[model samples]
Target: TVDKYGDNSIKLGITNMLIGEYLHTIDNKKRLAVPAKLRDKIGKKAVITRGLDNCLFLYPLKEWEALAEKLSKLPVGQGDTRSFIRLMLAGASEVEMDSLGRILIPDYLKNYAELKKDIVIAGLYNRLEIWDKEKWSLYKENAGRNSEEIAEKLGELGVY
Candidate 1:
């Protein structure tokens, strides 16, 4: 479905992917309203976790299960790998979306992301990244300025 933002999440028969940036707010109780366009794809149940770059990652149940499976197979002998696994798995919380399409953000995660009243829910394929509005704005500005350099690196990796 295309939202007012004109972003499309489904294409070519693929399922469970998302795309868009939605401006929303968390209430005094820390309940976040998931965009209707995204809630269906995200499913009634989701996983919320600490993500990199000080943002929270919200994943659909199926995707999170798949990711957990893959993460379980990584080399446990590597110290960094073990640490990374702990950071992800140990920090994850299974959340159920309410009838109003809301999910409660745990205090730890809210504090971790430094979330204020305003937020930007960015729909990244297979997950949503919740960022504080100001941080998202600054990060977008910096990333926009570096897009050419970033694309060059992706090109080197044969991904651009």
Candidate 2:
């Protein structure tokens, strides 16, 4: 299991964790059954928030706390960072899986991410990202188009 406690101490903990992609439907009432493999690492409780790719991000409690700290550091008077913090925080929700590993996503968040029935859940290092299927497909296409250019830019930043 990933070290939940260690995740608490650092604002961002790193873990390879279980990585896969799965598609499931959000029920009429906005309930989703988390994949079993992810459940084992995150346990029953999780914090969900907005992510950069117009998708939902799920983090363990400790990981969420770490993120909260970083967001808190953003100046309220600033433009971009403040807006980011507000949007991300406003979309955040805390949820726990039932015995069957089902989580009830609030309607507001569902609407924010334009999520309907089908959702794609993917493991991304320390956290998980959920996307509406069609939206995710579009995102992948966009990313693919920019992949080479983006890599070149990263290399210029000494990221290579």
Candidate 3:
């Protein structure tokens, strides 16, 4: 249920807390420099996991703890909740940024998200999502494709 908030939360996190975008290059080895703005808030130690979208998820330890705390109270009988918990917790990896503020993204995750030479790091509330640049472009274009339908739906909810 923790992840069940409307997609608006996703947009709000990215635009409000994240506030800006950092387009950076990923090395051949999948190493990336954490944006200075984000690094200042996240510190050297962080956690990485599978994101809801097709992107690698990054979180500060404190943020992960908050999420974990919220998830702990969910009913265990719900299959979807269990699956989300398993995927999020099992995929999480604790990592430390190197002296140069770089973190090594796991190969499996990189391959899962198709992250390679170029990447985009954006803030999303308590966490961050890393996206392959080209994939991000395509995703952005498609995300806007149904804007009118989305607006109409939001209007029904008194959000527009």
Candidate 4:
């Protein structure tokens, strides 16, 4: 089967699944070093944008393109949809890794996510989510406490 992009669906099945959580530091210049393992999957260029829960989402160029295509097709009449699309698209920035595999986070993005010196880079399948270390810690604690309830809800959705 071919997708709307004319690419074989089977080929799309072979996607890079980013996993694991890594701790790193954002230098004074606002650059964060992409983990060598994660860099291998994300390539040299990517799109970074504001994400839900006060984090930044980093998508490899190809993944970002696919997402953008779908988002573009959403009905503009719906206020929620329009706001969501604007939030993701308007906040997006193209970033290229430097020789040392570091990508600079714009000050605006850093401020939005409250990213300080300590940061957490969490790999979530097709994308990476960058979180402020303190915020991530608090979020993780809350999520862990609710894991059982969350799992039950997902089970209702046939996830389990």
Best by TM-score: 4
Candidate 4 structure quality by residue, lDDT tens digits, 50-141: 99999999998888999999999999999999999998999999999888999999988999999989999999988999999999999999
- Model 1 residue 97 CA deviation (Å) reads 0.6
Ten residues in a row with the worst lDDT in model 2? 4-13
Per-candidate RMSD vs. true structure?
5.2, 3.7, 7.2, 4.4
lDDT of 3 by residue, 1-160 (tens): 1232111222233433544567999887778999876675666788888887788888877678888888888887999999998878888888888888999988878887888788988776667889999988888788799889989999999999
Q: After best superposition, candidate 3 residue 87: deviation in angstroms?
A: 1.6
**TM-score computed on alpha carbons, candidate 2:** 0.84
lDDT measured at residue 65 in model 4 versus the true structure, 0 to 100: 98
Rank all candidate structures by their TM-score, best first, as comma-separated numbers: 4, 1, 2, 3
Q: How accurate is candidate 2 locally (lDDT)?
A: 0.81
Off by over 4 Å in 3: 1-16, 151-160
| Cα lDDT over the full model 4 | 0.89
